[model samples]
Target chain A: MLGLNNRDTRFFLIVIALTLFTPFLLQPFPEGSAMAQFNAGYPDLMQRFAIYGIFAIGFNILLGLTGYLSFGHAAFLGVGSYSAVWMFKLLSLNVIPGIILAVIVSGIFALIIGYISLRRSGIYFSILTLAFAQMSFNLAYSVLTPITNGETGLQIRLNDPRILDGEGASQYTNLFGLDMSSSFKLAMGDYVFTFNAGYYFCAIIAIAAFYLSLRIFRSPFGLMLRAVKSNQHRMNYTGLNTRPYTLAAFVISGMYAGLAGGLLAAMDPLAGAERMQWTASGEVVLMTILGGTGTLMGPILGAGFIKYFENIFSKINDNILHAWFSALPDGLEGFLVTIIHPFVGKGWHLTLGLVFMLVVIFLPGGLVEGGQRIKTMFSRKKNSDAASDVKPAE
Target chain B: MDAILLQTLNGLDKGAAYALIALGLTLIFGTLGVVNFAHGALFMIGSFCAVTLQRLLSISYTTIDPEKTDFLGNPAKIETPYIEGWFGPEIGAAIIDWSVPLAIIFAIPIMVTLGFIMERGLIKHFYNRPHADQILVTFGLAIVLQEIIKYYFGANPIPTPAPTAFKGSLDIGVMIGFDPNAIIYPIWRLIYFVFSLIVIGGIFAFLRFTTFGMVVRAGMADRETVGLLGINIDKRFTIMFGIAAAVAGLAGVMYTPINSPNYEFGMEFLVLSFVVVVVGGMGSLPGAVMAGFLLGILGSFASMNEVKQIFPGIDQIIIYLVAIIILLVRPRGLMGRKGVMEE
Candidate 1:
């Protein structure tokens, strides 16, 4: 319970330990083991987990703190991704410049949307954001085809001239002297530990973003934002213009989304307009809610949980299920697997829907509240036992 | 001028769909104050109603015929349904030909029951929750419903054909004393337009004339006060929800011939319908209907090849562009009543 105050530091330690040692833990299993196949310890998926974590964290700031539920935040992420990819195409492959450009472009886009949408509050605001996001998605798919590459998506071409490196060109760019596509591997006995350079890069950025969020959470500005959420009328009556605070929060979250989007493109230099679709926006909302909306750690945990499930569950073919079930009785194992089959594999979404329903119904405050409850129960049990001993002494 | 008329006709056909779905959305929002995200899924299930009825009608017994060699070189003896036994061959053939239109009668009650179960089982529990939670739960329900439809229907689009009689297009240009092939319009699309008008009119007539309609409208205005009078406003609201579901179902049934019934059809138009509802103002029936037509027309105009040359991507964004402008100018919408979504 006391560690809750320094939960961020504790979480940081946990992340570092896991990232450093996961390879050792992952290596003992055979190369073709199911655990190996499902290993998120692989850099590509881990990078995605961190990037999406940042995106969800940004969404939580708006939905959790301000109580302004946005069904359209994916537009910013899409904009960021597109811009990042374009940067790679037109300029040097250095993700630093690409990421900066993405943030700026996405920020400006958010400014216009926030300015207009902030005029409405509550559900109207939600609808307004959704409408705008939908429009952006449509435009990207069609009219912006030349720019966004529509459904086919935009990708890097090796034929392009590289002014930064000159003459002979490369399809991909390096990240501040390190190759974006490179991996770092360590070996111990029969075990192999492969660490993705990009994963570490994203991990660093996520840590910095997390700290920034913590600062925002503790500041007076954050306090005002929460006050506005609780009672906007009271804040208005007190002579505070709640619009600016909300707008600021909207912009900040929008930039965070841009950062995440840039990281995605940096890792893989392809951007599709579908990334900006309303469904993508809704995903972050689900992630934020599934974790613990207002809690800082919830979004990251939620992002990891969702991405892990999406990757792991989607890969569970009939063969994989049968492998696990073979130890049981012939008829019984087949029956059990058949019942669970539709809820995984291509049907992984069914399981996701069930989890979301349970979370909404039972754990309204999400996993953070569940954690608190467990902590409270243990403390109460110890206190009761101490009281019993005191009564005997008396 | 000819192009304009043709586009308007095209717009009206599309508008008919927007209006029907929006009308249902408005009715539910008016009475229950619950934004059911699963409404689109209901519309989808309604379209599948035709597919189901068609399957039911296709229960023909096959017999091997040595004399007849079909594509597979098998015997071709097909037995028709009981309807064929009752009606003569010509009339029965025609009736079977128009089964999609006939499915409308079957869809209404089925869709209504589906709506009722959904409201009572899932939506009722979410009545006191925040709009976001209601949205999340219903969205989940929508995904589940769509997946179920996908499982049954598979991923491909299944073409539900119009009857042979209405298969061709009409040359309205010649009727208007212009060139013959200038303004060609499909006969079935015209039927869809007329059918939507009748359905819309019937709903308006019922709401305006019937005692039950009056009670529902009263409930929408103030449920607490209506309940205080011992009228059981919640029950009426539930009925209103059923009617809304039926309205969407009818739209889907008629819509089958226009485009094939596909599992994703519901989501395809869901956003556009929501835009229509917002631009028309939430919970306002006339507003929904009006905005639906207006946006549909405007959207069609924006999507015209000529229009695209000028603005590039106006078609993709036309509905949203209209929505944004409306929200900015009249925060309550063009016809939205005050205090509907303010709380």
Candidate 2:
């Protein structure tokens, strides 16, 4: 709401509809098409899309709203994931309890870390968080080996006694008669579209999160957060304690990461220490900046874009390039494939670098601003014509 | 006492590297105010330079030797370098034999040009951006650089051996009269420590004595004021970047023999070096150099058996534990200046 106007709401709805329905529409792409790859229908990837989207959204609340650049958010996510997995192992595998545990644990962690880290603002805050996150990562990797399972990653073993199942030792049953692994598919004229049930479940959760964010954006609490972002010292002089507000934002965002991590473990019951790594934390920052920080939809769009490209681009190989380029001249095709070969698979990272660089350089406001500029350009032409036509009527 | 002495010796070699890399990082941050996430990548590239030199020297074509027999009673296969065809056998063989030592000359120019390109091409565009943006872009650049290295060299670590003359360990225990092998240390590591000290001393002396270094130091203190005095601060900053790059590169080259060169090696050093830089005070060169060795020795001690007995897993988090304590007690770090971040 800070950035969005009335028209933007309509555009956002359209984009969301497109994002949701595209999978169903692209079902019949003869197994492989550019459109088919966009099927946000796969359970694994769609779960990730929602999980990472939630993580980015939470990140944006602090970074975008409060202007504090945290470099260690992944520690909370990792902590949340570990907490949730432990809940599954120790208590019930029902996701709700697991998620609640994750949020509570991660919030406590953020409370401690934020209390100290938020003492300094700007770059110092960033470095402090980074240092603390590194501490968490190291601890998780080594000292907490029994809890985190060290480098091999923490997973749900068959030996994990499902106490909720009453000594039956079976996997936890899904609540509400909703199958987590089930997929909904539609077919029409060689086009088959499939959507995972977990996706819809995740989608519903995302919408709820988005609505909460919207409410936050509109509330007096959000205003205080913005004021803190603009000028903390001034807010302090105005008799409003900035500490509580900043800490609140930190805890809220930490819970959001916790929820995401919990969902990730639910959809796939494995949590690795690598999830808590500084690089993983840095990734959400990149996603937020690249999408359009501070906007409700920006982080979601950024998450989808990054994940899609990461998956699809890494899948591309020499054969794929050769298939497309073979339609050209014999010599030219070979040359083109070789040129494109290095930028795919492991080389996909190069593309990510270029995208990040371009986004930072030319689109500082991110894709949200880029979209706004395009809309303004189109609307200006219509507005000018309407003004000239209205002059005759006047 | 012997164990303590050995650990101290172990730390000096590591401390020397930490100082060298942190010096470069602090130099760039001091002059440009940009937190370079790619400094580690430059260190990585420097190590690869050694790898390349080893590859270049070892390039040979195989040929069947009709007169000589193999262990299996077959004709022996002899290998000859391509250089032998162009140059005379004597010079070619000598050059091939001595390529690892010759990599220093090759690495200098390559590393310098890479520094110039990095500063001019990517970092130049981010000068006006926020620190976060600079961090992100440079980080992206670091990933790209590391990925390229991985693509070329594969994921495995490549051992870059030192010259044959410096292959064995030096027995410092015999001289000190504690058991003959108690203070045994690698010859290359000793050489590296000495080399680092000379380079560090030379850099310090240059800054202390030279007019160029004086102007650079002046620029670091205040760029606008130096610019007002009709000096080209941008040029000095660029040269400082080059110097920083060369320092990291040389550190990396010397380090190749200690730990094998791998794509992810820089990331490990990068994290520790950042801690060193923060502990040393963000823009203080002397602080960086001092803290590098301090942290290195402290970390080494934390990993020792005696330290482990006191704190079960202290080694895993010793650097960060120290960083947190320092930030809490002295937020501006040990020798940090006023107006620096004080938590």
Most accurate candidate by DockQ = 1
Q: Name the TM-score of candidate 1.
A: 0.93
**What 10-residue stretch in candidate 2 chain B is worst by lDDT?**
B93-102
lDDT by residue for model 1 (A256-323), tens: 99999999999999898888888788789888888888887788778888898998789998888898
What is the C-alpha lDDT profile of model 2 across B1-343, one tens digit per residue? Answer: 9998888888988899899999999989988888898999999998999899878876889999899999998999988888886687878876765665577788888888888888888787777777878887888788888888988998899988787778899999998788888889999889989989998998899888999999998998888999999998898888888888988998998899889989988888887898888888888889899999999888888889988989978988888888777776787878888875443
What DockQ score does model 1 reach against the true complex? 0.61
Query: lDDT (CA) for every model shown?
Result: 0.83, 0.82
lDDT of 2 at A323: 75
**iRMSD, per candidate, in listed order:** 1.5, 1.8
Please give each candidate's TM-score.
Answer: 0.93, 0.93
Task: Give the runs in model 2 whose Cα sits over 4 Å from its true position.
Answer: A1-22, A25-40, A167-173, A384-394, B69-76, B83-98, B341-343
Question: Which sections of candidate 1 miss by over 4 Å?
Answer: A1-8, A15-30, A34-36, A167-170, A187-191, A384-394, B70-95, B175-179
Candidate 1 per-residue C-alpha lDDT over B1-343 given as tens digits, one digit per residue, 9 for 90 to 100: 9988888888998899999999999998888888877788788888999988877766565456778777876777667665666686677677778888989999989998988997888778888898778888888777788777876787788788888999999998999898989999999999999999999999999999999999988888888899999998888778888889998988988898888878778877787788888889988999999988888788788878999899988888878888988887887777899977744
Worst 10 residues of 1 chain A by lDDT: A385-394
